[model samples]
Target: MFMRAGLTIGEFSQITHLSVKMLRRYHEVGLLEPDRVDESTGYRYYSTAQVPNAQVIHRFRELDMPVREIKAILATPEPEARSALISEHLRRLERQLDTTRAAVTSLRRLLGPASPPLQVELRTSAAQSTAAVQAMVDQEEILRWYDGAMTELDAALADACLSQSGPPGGLYDNALFTHERGSATVYVPVTATAPAIGRVRPFVVPAAELAVTVHHGPHDDIDVTYGALGTYVAEHALAVAGPVRETYLVGPPDTADESAWRTEIGWPVFRTGIRVSG
Candidate 1:
């Protein structure tokens, strides 16, 4: 009987602390190919020298790195290049973890008792001249759409040498929240008549009487604040005609800490109702 040149698949699995199934998957994906294969018996064998590589693959897998990305990392020969690949994946994992943490915190608060009293104010906003961009966007893509739109508006404002009158604001159409697809308009108030360029054009944001509340921290739990405000509006019969208005007081480009973020949510209402005073 001829002995194998290296460790058999079972021995290799023991040495690498990988399951037989996992090892086979690694082989199948060309991630950690076996050192040799016996053609007659169709047996797979891995060399002892492959232990380190197997361990690295295991660690990356534990980190939830995608197999394709792991393959890219392993294929790169340069130390710096490999480090960059790993760093990129680590950053992505961090972002995912952050989102998870935020969700957990948000869920706990939502599941618990009713939130503290929120001061809803009624204020009449005067009609304003503005440079704005409007587009139909999905709910999931609203954040990305907002970022790009704001960037464009900023560039247009710069090109036109116009100074912003106030913090940037957005008008979210009802269809957006109702059907999850609708028109979204992002704008910056400008002092004078601004030239219409590209998607950024001059328009008038109609005035409205709004019942408003400030949402603190990240938007992960903003729906809670929205719910509270909505309840207050419905209970008082203050809800009237208009899409929701958001005034981004302290947002990105201003602060990276979500805890420090402040957004003002406004529900349109009739100015005549004298129920709750601000």
Candidate 2:
């Protein structure tokens, strides 16, 4: 039956829908073997009867089954274990597919034009109940230290650095992007009624009149947005006195993508209202 329906590698590939490179790899891996090889040119020929098995291997690999796992299953020579291994791989792939779908949906939301440039809003924001981690952070080390500090807070407290208890914020003492590198504190609100955890207590970032702009997206390109907002403020003659702060209204874990983040950038300023320069 096999010799009666023998096929060349190209014909086998067309029938099985697996690439020639993949067929070669399967041969090398001992998952599948060519039924014949030309003695002179070393070309391979596969029997059409083997096409169904090749299709099965292709489907399993597409589902992200590890090559080693596939080899083991093929070598097991048992009906039960092979079926069980396939089931386990299916469950894992389903979970990853769901996560990928969520990310796609979130990206779609973020792809829209950024919300209209911050309309200047003037209001005295009251001081907030704060939990902060202070550290000397170089630009390269900032993200690492932040992750560790955030994890520490997560393990120890109920509300975290980005979670809203009052107003979530961070105070940068020096510019990290321009490489002036210095200390910074990532702050978040705590439960007012509850007692402080260790040094995490009521810390104030000073209630002040701020010139704020709403940024709806990831923080990666936030500097451009900052420059625009700063230009707007400067044209209106506002002097930024203190550290610029970010109030995270939406975050990555809260949303599926980083692009879905919504942050309020507030530059503590002295000048207010639309002023005309004479």
- Candidate 1, TM-score vs. the true structure? 0.77
What tens digits encode model 1's per-residue C-alpha lDDT throughout 199-260? Answer: 99998899899998999988878877888999988888878868999988998779999789
Instruction: Write model 2 residue lDDT over 62-120, tens digit each, in one string.
Output: 87888888887777778998888878888677757655665675556457677564566
| Runs off by more than 4 Å, candidate 1 | 1-4, 14-17, 28-33, 48-60, 65-95, 111-114, 252-260, 270-272
Which has the greatest TM-score?
1
After superposition on all CA atoms, how large is the RMSD of candidate 1? 4.0
Which regions of candidate 2 are displaced past 4 Å? 1-118, 159-164, 177-179, 193-202, 275-278
| Cα-based RMSD of candidate 2 | 8.5
Worst 10 residues of 2 by lDDT: 193-202
lDDT of candidate 2 at residue 79, scale 0 to 100 = 91
Candidate 1 lDDT: 0.88
